[model samples]
Target: MPVIEIENLRKTYSMDGGLSVEALCGVSLCFESGEFAAIMGASGSGKSTLLNILGCLDPPTAGRYLLNDDNVAALEGERLAALRNENIGFVFQSFNLLSRTSALENTELPLMYNHSGLGMTEIRRRALAALDRVGLAERADHHPNQLSGGQQQRVALARALVNEPSVLLADEPTGNLDSRTTLDIMALLQQLNDQGMLIVMVTHEQEIGAYTRRILEMRDGLIIRDSPVENRRHARAEASGESTTRLNATES
Candidate 1:
């Protein structure tokens, strides 16, 4: 079964003044494990709307969304929330870190929120490990303001991975950083993909999207182009000496 599925997903919003806007008309796609895909579009192209639905942050007005073969669009209440927490990791363009908390605290927030059975010691350990994955272990004691834009983003990425989700969804992750920092974050994401993490990113920059195995261009709430880079797995494998980099994702 496909890890993620979206079929004819539709979303429409009605404003207070009775203005109805159709964000997504009818879109369909499927994502498999260990795939790194980029979704790109211009403003008002419904990229964010589609991403929200895929991440379970919002519901579509009409659609068939299956996360691990379960109809996520049909789930409600705690079931929906639990599925989201268990299967998805989210990263935003802005490094959404708390102001006064240490990086370790921020990374542990997910496990602390849903998995209260874990002792603080274990949470701290896993949090630090996630920090190490992003090469931010030394900065685990630092707060958001103390780190560079790239470092802060890495902290956020660590927080997302601390839960060990099936898919990592990033929305405009490089929007706030400089060119150098953007490249650094992209490299980190490349490394994560190499580690067999399924990643779906929304970006406006073509250069950043080039790093992914697949590029999905969305326009008017539909996927217009879905193209894969030739030899993407080979490119990834040569980047690191890790068995995870050898894993390949299968699409339906």
Candidate 2:
């Protein structure tokens, strides 16, 4: 079964003067387990709107979204929040770390929302493990201001992974990083995908999109192009100054 499945997903915003602007006009998509996919588009192309719905941050105006076969539209209030916390992990462009908190504390934020009744020791252990996965275990006690941009982003990634979510959602996660750091983060994302964690990312940069196995381009609230990357760029190779090449062609 697909990890995520959406059928005719639609979202519209009611603006001033009884005007309604459609953000997503019947987008249908399916993401399988272990897939590394990128959503690409220009500004106002609805990519962000789709990501919001997928992250459970917003509800679609119409249609169905199934996460692990649970009807997302059917969940409400605390149940929806719980579902999102349990299954969806989010990383954003801004890093979104609490500057006053330590890396380990930032990572434990997600678990704090969890209703599983976990003890503090267990939460700390999971947070530390998550930081280790993102190569930031040694910086567990460092505050956000003490870390570099890339390191801060890694902290955000660690926070996302601390929940052991079924899927990782990243919105322009590398936007604030330099080119070198961009590749570094992409390499980490690739490694996570290789380890069987499903990842869906939003990026407008063509070069950045090439690092993913699949790219879906949206325009005017619709996915105009959904194709497997013909020449996937391996971030590890790029980071190591080695040329890499791979080819495949498939369409969604």
**Model 2, range 1-252, lDDT digits (tens) per residue?**
899999999999999999999999999999998999999999999999999999999999999999999999888878789978899999999999998899999999999999997899999999999999999999999999999999999999999998899999999999999988998999999999999999999999999999999999999999999999988888888877632222222221
Q: Number of the top candidate by lDDT? A: 2
The reply for model 2, stretches above 4 Å from the true place, is 242-252
- Global lDDT of each candidate: 0.87, 0.94
What clash pairs does model 2 have? none
Against the hidden reference, what TM-scores do the models get?
0.89, 0.95
lDDT per residue, candidate 1, 91-201, as tens digits?
999989988999999999888876457898999999999999999999899989899999999999999999899999999999998866776788789889888899999
What is the Cα root-mean-square deviation between model 2 and the actual structure? 6.2
**Candidate 1 overall Cα lDDT vs. reference?**
0.87
How does candidate 2 score on lDDT? 0.94
